[model samples]
Target: MTSPGVHAFLIIVRVDRFTPEEKNTVDFIKKIFGDGAAKYCIVVFTREDQLEEGQTIDDFINSSDQLKELVQCCGNHKFAINNKLNGQPLKIKIDQLLRMIDQMVQSNRGKYYTNDMYQKIERQRKREQARQEEEDRKKKKAYEESLISTGREIGRQEAEERERERQKEQKSREKEPQKTEKPEKEQYSTREKICGCSCHKYPGVIHVVPCCSGTKFPFSLLGP
Candidate 1:
């Protein structure tokens, strides 16, 4: 059944005794083909000759809840056949089973379960996972870069603040040096007289006399 797929799954059982394991066969098939397999299933009850006289398949199914539940899971499609029959009777049973399968196919819109369908679902799932991972990676990278940028800005601001504080401290401690200046010398006049004499008559005689105060007088200033 796994090589390709099938249009229907016939669950065969004996009408004389429907075992617990047999009742769960449809569930096992669903596990293999997925939940959609149930719609394409048909429960076929064999050994109809063992049934009580005037007992129909529906009457037998209604008597047991387990059988009824199983049939309902298969869209309530069920059939009974006596394997001991031959010729036209056996052919009729086979033809009826085939007709039921054809009706199911028509109800399914002419589509069959295939391995390709499962593969396509798996491929789509992988593609979606890859896309989500890529998006998450981009978001994480952007968040890291933003954090780095914020850290650099904070470091720059702190450095600038430290430099400003240092400059202010230096300015507060600075002072100008004091300066000293020299005094100027006194100037002397040359027109002062040393003695009380009128010496305006002298023509060229140059003299140097010393007064009592130790000051010097010229010869042109001596008295007659």
Candidate 2:
């Protein structure tokens, strides 16, 4: 349907015998092509040999309500041809069709057929595509932002956990009991001052000795 796009659409029909389905095609064409469609459409009738003597295309139109209505819808553009006939008759029909085409072209100032509805549809399609692309871009940006936000949240939580651990350790150290030891008092004993044979009782003659030093009296000190 999209091939080469349509410059003009030919609607062929058997003038003498029209089926219900065929008659409906006219309305369908108009619907698809829109208002400008009629200008480029031509009603072509086949089976022209079926016409009785002196019967013409006008006579056929006058005879059939469906045909007349279809022609009117196409702006009264109609032509007839008989492929079954040969020589002069076929030539005449072909010539008549060409003349009608010429007249239509001239009336339209040599403009080719165009479908306003098709163009409108194409424009709408472009607009829709652009809108979809914009939506996709917004979604992508939102996804990236979400990832960034998640990362920041995770980093903050980790930092807070570390801070909590540090505070817990500080509080533990503060709560621990401190140990203190008092200085011990030295014990002194009054001993008879005897050094050799000149020892005399005197407070200055003796010095303070540590009890854990394994010391003995003066007589033991003189032994070795």
Candidate 3:
């Protein structure tokens, strides 16, 4: 009968004696079907006739913190029913329970409970997590690559700027005037020719003549 899936899980418990085991009932259901089972749960508190006069279901729920927490975990969906009731009263409570189940179905977007649903949902979650991680890794890699590329570009630009400065300095040096060396002073000899003779008489040079007399003169003496 349960091959297809169940729309609601009626967790019936006696209101007169809400035991500790009863408080842990929803937890057991979660253990079997998964945490999503809580949304489809409708807590049916049987034996509402035992409640003291003027003591409502809310009053009973508020009396116990554990019970209250459990109910809250089940989306606060609860119903009180007196099993001894007959006829239209029972019918009305049954109708209200059906309506609550219908509302729960609508809230769940017309989904039902199955073990396969939990496994499928877990698989989807894992797939989504892996996809997100892969995307993040790609983004990180791209960012790192961009940083390295930017650094290289900056280094290239700086090198180009330095080269330009060097070229500019070289051109400036080429445009500047050059210094010329002074000409060397003429050298003069201290000795000179003495007497006039057929031999060449050289100024500022000494000569011993083969004339009637051989003589030598200083550089200050001039030949006649």
Candidate 4:
């Protein structure tokens, strides 16, 4: 089916097994074959024995949706193959089928499908496949880059959050140190001094004599 440069495409569709999938295959095959797919295409219906008792292939075509669509895709070109036919009748059907093929070839300027055309088609298909692959790679790279960018953004946000939390903790610690601090006491106090004589220093008050003003004496100098 992948072979290129086919002048004619014979779509073998079973008369009895006609289904939507078969009908859909017509469009798919055309895609695989590319341009000039329809002109040389033919729809050959098999299993003609399953036709209604008095009905011809046309009757079947008229009754079935899949058959109608198949015929339409092949430019209304359709034929039936019944191997059961023998002698002159079989020959006649064969001749008819050949004549139709001949007409199609003739219409195509007697150009039969050849390897040269196939090679050309194949090369073109390869080029297209390469292009599509490149495009897919680019898309994949873009998607990956987007994921990395998103991850970086998330990491940056997380780092900022951690820094904010750290700053908040530091501020809280600073306030705690202030709140738990004790009142400042004087390093040097004159009240710690007393007279060296028999005079006792007033309680919690500073009383310095003229002679002991320069002296740092303990209040125990006045023994009880």
Q: What lDDT does each candidate get?
A: 0.78, 0.71, 0.80, 0.75
lDDT of 1: 0.78
By TM-score rank, best first, the candidates go: 4, 1, 3, 2
Can you write out model 1's per-residue Cα lDDT over 144-178, one digit (the tens) per residue?
99999999999999999999999998887675444
Query: Candidate 3 or 4, higher TM-score?
Result: 4
TM-score of each: 0.52, 0.47, 0.51, 0.72
Count of backbone clashes, every candidate in sequence: 1, 0, 0, 2
Relative to the true structure, candidate 3 reaches a TM of 0.51
Model 2, 1-224: lDDT tens digits are 44334545677888667888777776776555556657767888898878888899789888978878888877788878876978997788788787787787667667655455577756766787899999999999999999999999999999999999999999999999987887675345435222222233442343334222344445322211
User: Tens digit of lDDT per residue, candidate 4, span 1-224?
Assistant: 33344557788888767667778777776566656567788888888988879999898888977677778878888889885889999999889998999898888888776676656777888999999999999999999999999999999999999999999999998787445678798554445544454334544444443333455465543433
RMSD of 4: 5.9
How well does candidate 2 score on lDDT at residue 130? 100
RMSD per candidate (Å) reads 15.8, 11.9, 11.5, 5.9
10 residues in a row with least lDDT, candidate 4: 203-212
For candidate 2, list the clashing residue pairs, or say none. Answer: none
Per-residue lDDT for 25 in model 1? 91
Which ranges of candidate 4 are over 4 A from the true structure? 1-7, 177-224
Candidate 1: Cα lDDT at 80: 87
